[model samples]
Target: SYKPNIAFYEAHGLKGWQALEKTIAYLNEKCPDHFTIADAKRGDIGNTSSRYAKAFFEELNFDSITVAPYMGKDSIEPFLEYENKHTILLALTSNVGAFDYQTKMIGDQMLYQKVIDISKEWKNSRNLMYVIGATKAEYLADVRKIIPDSFLLVPGVGAQGGSLEKVCEFGMNDQVGLLVNSSRGILYASNGRDFAEAAAKKARELHVQMKKILINY
Candidate 1:
């Protein structure tokens, strides 16, 4: 799967958007079997969210998109309305600032737990996936108790100090439900003419490690 975080493209204005569109188009045409995530972290009021949903799922034709769950069910429903698409909610992020709220105990459950638990009751909740950072792999077991069957997008491996072994150990469901994205490490794998080859080398390294882990499972 290729996750192109729109922020990286949007920083360049119109050309950035065009680049993103062309990128997605190329992927859809050449790598149709691969999943594409519009890592836009969007969630707003109902009407506004509908447009956002269309912009990614229809306009850009992404299979999935990351979203912020801070706005509650109504804000998320617009995205969920899509039949075959996925709405990946922000659960426990890999960032340092996550401790500010996500892990806080709230009436016997953490805030992220509350978000996950409540989300299950929403319309089309079956389409909901989640973001569980690799850096927070220790907490993944507890998260699994709530959404064991749901797919998780696990970032923070490589440059972010997250151990792939730890993430796979605690977060893997029977379906092998994890998408470990290693953008920075792969992108900057080399700063010379061998850059593309180096990035592929890094990705193959992760793939080999993952295959080894799954073999024991």
Candidate 2:
């Protein structure tokens, strides 16, 4: 799976948009079998959400998109309407700022748990997934309890100091429903002439570790 966070591209202005388009096109041409995620973290009102859904799933042709669930079901339902596409909701993110609201206790359960529990009742939730940070890998056990079979997109593996072994131990389901992402760790592996080679080497290391973890599962 390849997840290109839109922010990285958008930061470069027009060239960023061009690069993003070309990247997606290249992925489609070279590896159509691989899942592509647009890490946009978008969530808006019904009308605007519909357009965002069309832009990513229809126009951009990404297999899935990361969406913020703060606006409630009305904002997210538009994305869920797409049968073949996936809507990955932000739950426990891999950033320091997540401590602000996501972890606050709402009675016996944390806020993120409430988001997961309530989202489970949303229509067409079978196509739903959650973003749980690898930085908080220990919480995976608790997250699995809310939605045992749902897929989880875990970022913060490399540059963010997340442990893949810890994530796999508690986050992996019978279906192996976890996508551990390493962006800067792989992208910026080298700034010299051998950047691509260095990136490949970094990716291979993660792949090897993942394979080892999968063996135990």
Candidate 3:
């Protein structure tokens, strides 16, 4: 599966959008079996939310999209409405700032816990997945207790110094529930023309490592 951060292309305006469209087109044509994720943390009011959902889920033909949960169900249900698609909510992010809000206790539970617990009751909640930062491997146990069956899209595994071993240990479910994204660690493996080769090598190393862990587990 491929996850592209829209900001890198959106920063270029129309030309960027065209490029992104072309990229998605090529991926869909050549790699139909692979899942495609538009890593746009989009959420807004009703009409605006519907537009964003249409833009990614319909126009761009992405299989899933990441979204912010701050706006609650109204901003999210529009995305969830699409069948055979996924809406990935921000639960516990993989960043330093996560401790600032996500971990802070709102009552007996942390704020992130409340976000996850509440989201399960929303319309079409079965379409929901979550973004849990791999850096927060320690918190995976608590998160799994809430959504044990839902998939988790985990970032920060490579360049951000997150341990794959630790993440799998606490985050793995019966479904092998994880979609780990590593951007710079693979994409920037080299600056030369051999970059694709280098990137593939890095990805393969991680793949082999993951397979070993799963086999042992």
Clashes of each: 0, 0, 0
Better of 2 and 3 by lDDT: 2
User: What lDDT does the true structure give each of the candidates?
Assistant: 0.95, 0.96, 0.95
TM-score of 3: 0.98
RMSD of 2: 0.9
TM-score of each: 0.98, 0.97, 0.98
Q: Residues 155-176, candidate 3: write the lDDT tens digits.
A: 9988998989999999999999
Per-prediction RMSD in angstroms?
0.7, 0.9, 0.8
- Between candidates 2 and 3, which one is better according to TM-score? 3
Give stretches of model 1 more than 4 Å off.
none
lDDT of 3 at 54: 99
Clashing pairs in 1: none
On the 0 to 100 scale, the lDDT of residue 216 in model 1 is 95
Tens-digit lDDT string for candidate 2 (2-103): 998899899999999999999999999999999999999999999999999998999889999999989999999999999989999999999999999999
Q: Tell me the tens digit of each residue's lDDT in model 1 across 1-217.
A: 9999899999999999999999999999999999999999999999999999999999999999999999999999999999999999999999998999999998989999999999999999999999998999999999999999999999999899899999988999999989998889898899999999999999999989988998999
Better of 1 and 2 by lDDT: 2
- Candidate 1 structure lDDT: 0.95
